[model samples]
Target: MSFKNLPLLGTAEIIGALNLSPKQTASAANLAHRVAQSAWRRQPPHKRGLSYEEFASTVSDCAWLTMFEFGALLALGRHHEALLLADASRMVHHSARTDPPK
Candidate 1:
């Protein structure tokens, strides 16, 4: 048996959730991942449970869901949005490091 038929490894797994071709998956995944930070999130921002679980599981991993969301925007050449997301992620990390825990 071969593992080739299995789900992707590393970052490739990100776009695999979207049924995309191998060549397009990497960039698509990167773009979606950065911009789709809220893809699986509940719109109202306070709800979480089994219902949310089902919604959350739709893409297996958050990165995949993010890819599904941002892939379309990437298709439209939204590189700036993707960059902004990356910067925001960095800012979040920096803040977390600087802030004291409550």
Candidate 2:
């Protein structure tokens, strides 16, 4: 199936978990979308699109979960820690994408 026109894949679920304001939900959804696109681009061209299993796995990946945790931090008024966590998560994902496979 085509993922080209899809909205953020897990927006509803993210919103449910975040239970935050619109701006916060939008921020969380944007991060989730980025993670999903990154994961999608790693797939082979022939199979490069959203699949149920991949969607499940991508949303559950540590990177995305870290973003979810970020939302929780915002809810708890821990902005500094949330920013650190997001930066760390992005670094890890970038490293994974750039590192040579063993």
Candidate 3:
């Protein structure tokens, strides 16, 4: 799925929460996107065994989890953790495609 379809909150709410400048909100979305990708990977180690429907449902749940993490980190001003989550998200997102989500 496109990252744009990761099920984010309304833009106004997100920007309000972060208290960012309009310019900063753009970068904030990128940071929150890291959280979204992390949430996408929050599946069981036995994911290779799941059916397609199971995978889709799991993706939906993980997407929400990523949103949760993004909100917390943003509220706390945890930019560094956002970076780490972004890096981890990239790695996990890549590895899932590679090794089938172990």
Best by lDDT: 2
Off by over 4 Å in 2: 1-57
Please rank every candidate by TM-score, starting with the best. Answer: 2, 3, 1
TM-score per model over all chains: 0.36, 0.46, 0.39
Tens digits of per-residue lDDT, candidate 3, 1-102, equal 123534455555545665656456555555555554454466567655665445545555454445545644655678688668657866876877789534
Q: Of the pair 2 and 3, which is ahead by TM-score? A: 2
TM-score of candidate 3 on Cα atoms, chains taken together: 0.39
lDDT of 2: 0.61
| Location of the lowest summed lDDT over 10 successive residues in candidate 3 | 1-10
How much lDDT does each candidate structure score?
0.49, 0.61, 0.55
For candidate 2, report its TM-score. 0.46
Clashing pairs in 3: none
- Residue 20 of model 2 has an lDDT of 65
**Compared with the true structure, what per-residue lDDT tens digits does model 2 show for residues 1-90?**
222323344545555665667666655545555656666768787776777456646454455556555765666577998899888887
